[model samples]
Target: MDQPVYSAAAPRILIVDSSRNNLAVLARRLGAEGYRVMVAETATTALGELQRVPVDLLIADLALPLMSGTELTRVVRRELAWRDLPVILISGRSEADGVVRALAAGADDVVVKPFHFEVLTARIARLLERSTRVRQLAADNATLDERVVRRAIELGEARDRLKALEAELGRVG
Candidate 1:
């Protein structure tokens, strides 16, 4: 069987923007570059998308309609399954405090509005690569843990058998 093409395989992303025009622009830009863009106009809808499908990356506008992007990022970071999920937050407000707050709130990176598409794509690629590496490491760790448990069980069984043999010799003596 042929393996799936990683580059052709759309990297799924959830984009949260209030303006349909903005969403359209971002979705087109990413989709053109082989991303399967999923747009959500509100935080509630974005969370719903997350429940339905696993996203490789999240690009959220900080000034969402009902809930701020910061809150969404926090929720994703706190959630057990999505905690290590990569996020890039965008905002028109570029004040020092705003940028600092976004970063501190667990945003992998914050991009100010009127940003370059290439820059955004580069950041997304880097974040996704890092996430893949982390996931691989986690899987390796789980495998090692299982091996350790199995070895311990085997050692216990061997020790018990040895004890039984010793008891049999004692009876013979």
Candidate 2:
């Protein structure tokens, strides 16, 4: 879609899957594609990594040993800061059920397992691009907020000065 948004610093992706083999495969693939990969074998570790570093994208597999990807998405979305973060849920379960659950839990997209590396990479790129745009919009909003606040303060000061001058003139009169 949009030209791939290239950055000097590779985008970070947090992959949470209990299967060590799956984690390794995903890490290798993403790393080769220029993404900084972070692996977590459990939901706890994934949440901790999120706290320590804001990841560009999250790819989590349902049917994890202790915690499912759905649960992870719920926790992340509940937190105000991570609510808008893009999540891609991977599952080997029934596609319909898994997709519905992932969406309910706040995943941006869901991918069934037995996926091709190229397909996954394309999806990752799309998510990264979307996230980038969202972040840019947030930055723009913050800039506008700052400007509005500054202007409001300036106007208030000017009004105060005007009132003071009027009081002085009244006394003089």
Candidate 3:
């Protein structure tokens, strides 16, 4: 009998861009590079996509149709606090204020338009790696918390039994 082996799925990237060309090109390129790509032309649709499927990373255009990527990042950061999703905002503008605002709004990284695909890919990898580390740390913390609680409960039970034993000895003597 042969045992079944499970393989990891490719990382899923959700890209929100109002431009059809941007969405199409990125989906094609990223998919070719072995990433499962999901594209949305608007932030609202991007939110819907998030609800429908689990995404590893988000690459959003700064200038979306109904909502800007900054706004979208804020909403995702707030509403999906448990998910801790990594967000990258790509924009045509290079102003320092715009970059600062996006970061303040919870974007993990920002990429300027006409970016090299290699650089974008590197950023995605870094963000995903960081996110993975964070999740691992959180899981470790939860396990530690459970162990502490279990130990405390055991200590309490032992103390209770000790008291009962003392009472029995007192009555016997």
Could you tell me how far off, in angstroms, the CA of residue 111 lies in candidate 2 after the best superposition?
0.2
TM-score of each: 0.92, 0.89, 0.92
Off by over 4 Å in 3: 1-8, 81-83
TM-score comparison, 2 vs 3, better candidate: 3
The global Cα lDDT (0 to 1) of model 3 is 0.89
lDDT of 1 by residue, 61-92 (tens): 98887788998998888888888889999988
RMSD of each: 4.0, 4.3, 4.9
Off by over 4 Å in 2: 1-8
- Flag regions of model 1 displaced more than 4 Å: 1-8
For model 2, give the 10-residue run with minimal summed lDDT. Answer: 1-10
